[model samples]
Target: MDYLTATKNKKYLMYISQNYSYAILRPLQQEILAQGGEVKWFLEGNEVTSSFLKNNESHLLTIEEVIRWSPDVSFVPGNVIPPFIPGIKVGLFHGFNSGKRNRKGFEDHFNIRGCFDLYCTQGPNTTSRFEQLSKQYKHFAVKETGWPTLDPLFNPDTKSIYTQPDDKRKTLLICSTFSRNLSLAPKLYQTIKTFSEQGKWRILMQFHPKMPNELVTKYQALENENLTFIETDNVLPLLKAADVMLCDTSSILLMFILQRKPVVTFCNQDPGKHLLDVTEPEKVEAAIELALSHPAQLMDDIESFCQQLHPYQDGLSSQRVLAACNELVLTNPKLKPKPLNLIRNLKMRKKLNYWRW
Candidate 1:
């Protein structure tokens, strides 16, 4: 029997680098708690704030505190596993957009650099990719558990399509990746502004947490009655709230696509026929109108695309992830000591302002 079905309690430790990581682990944490499992969160870096602690009700753990705790499993969304931590290190992934490219071939999104003992993949595409990498690297395991961050989206009772009052205006969510060259924010700001000012639509803008501060400030100044600037780490609510999402080269586009809503991508690195691809900033307005006007035309394509990402729409993805982790704990009872990389650890410690001995 799985931990959820078993009558015993287990412990889960979450390693988070930023506030946005909470979205990826919150659903899993809820599931773990529901299954008589306890979870403790550790902030992995020094750039934390008092406001984060107050909002999350979690304390920051030093490297010593983390080692002393020695959790059964450590869930991380970022790449670094943090040297000398005990337990099964699991990478839950931050996003599903893996088909893009950097100067290097294939962009290395799903590449396993031995950071995780197990990876809870969002869907088949990611799983298949990681499976190949795992075979080649001869370490780590891949589990096809859908992303926990999107679990709330599949729940009917908790899913809210609109947070705003019923003004009956069409809602458009604008988002972008942090890449300056790939992001559409700089190129399409004027176009978005023009549309928002028309009063025909309600614009909700949520940028990547890594987006440059100056760009965030510039967009913050654009907030008004029709346009809302979202700065929160949790985007599940915003993802559910929006009628349509406008983005560029973001896996978030796939999340919105899973909603079966229309998505307009501006200069996406991996443009798909399922999405309305706008290469030019000038064409974004027309694409928005096209999406809002005839979303039904794209329903079949959207569903097909969603299936490739994740087959589950029943909100049990978090449960599946927990099941996978529990299976790892049960089968691999002896914890393997993660090999220490002194240079890497020291570099990270210095960068995050941890004590260097």
Candidate 2:
């Protein structure tokens, strides 16, 4: 019997190690449940808050429990998944590539960790690169299914649990990456504080979870009538509410730009015509003004950039992802097998204390 035909009740495991994974995989989970598939979550580390899991959502607490559950497939948003997990491991990346480089100066986004059996790429830029890597690795498959996280961003009917502030002020969202060297949080602090003091825009500041608590506290202190600091795992609502975004090299900026809205980025690593890249803190105010103005050329560049990044506006990427997974299972492509990855697997086993082979 074919894989899809034989499986009456498909069991899917959402393997998460970070808080952001919840937002990335929830849309896919919704699709799974709608299709009569059983979906369970397996949170590997303390970083992922258990409370985020809904009452109806099931979670496997231990590795032993996961082994017994025997899922048909596992979706991982983070880089690594234990090879011991009994499933076809699929990589659902946590975020878009924001041109951040690793310590070794290599593009971290395209780095293959020898774990996933398949990669559901976001768009043409990522798909073309992963396709090239797929050819070289010959171990995994690449499918250009849009990122599932943005399903709600594109879906107008989807009601957000988050309520934007009632104020009618033009919202200016400020976000920064956690990377110290790449972050503009510290550098642009005075400028943003001044902006809040002006009370011309409603400043909504949110930083990456991994950002230093000291810096977070510093920004939190800037809260006043004009400024509000937001802390949440899901940033979709904020993306929709904001008119203009001021960011550093964080991938969240990419998500904001996908709305075809203008963004003012500070010293972006890969500055493009799509963004209003400002070098100095003093230039930020002017950049924000230009972005808010929505210049004809700038808006055109943003639209063109978004097309290459994520063209799917239908919000049905989750369905496409499921279809891709089903097709892969049915075909059972004869690709090169994944590496043993003994060191990585050993580290994972030690972390989980699962020794049974």
Best by lDDT, which number?
Answer: 2
Q: Give the whole-model CA lDDT for all candidates, comma-separated.
A: 0.79, 0.90
RMSD, model 2, all Cα superposed?
1.8
Cα lDDT tens digits, model 1, 1-357, are 645554146667888878788777888887877777777888866443435544544554576676677788889988777655777889987778636775777566765556688888888767787888767665677789898888888888885644777677888999998988889888888887787688789988999888999989988888889899987877888888888889998888888788888899988878777889989877888888899876665877878888888888989988888888888887874434444667887787776566835
How high is each candidate's TM-score? 0.91, 0.96
Clashes of 1: 0
Q: What's the residue-level lDDT of 16 in candidate 2?
A: 96
lDDT for residue 271 in candidate 1, whole number 0-100: 78
Worst 10 residues of 2 by lDDT: 1-10
lDDT of 2 by residue, 1-357 (tens): 333333338888999998888888999988888877889999997798999999999989999999899988899998998988887899988899989899899899999999999999999999999999999999999999899999999998766543455777788999999888889998988999899899999888889999999999998998998898999989998888889999999999999999899999998999999999999999999889889999999999998998899999999898888877877776789889899999999999999999999
* Candidate 2 segments exceeding 4 Å error: 1-8, 159-166
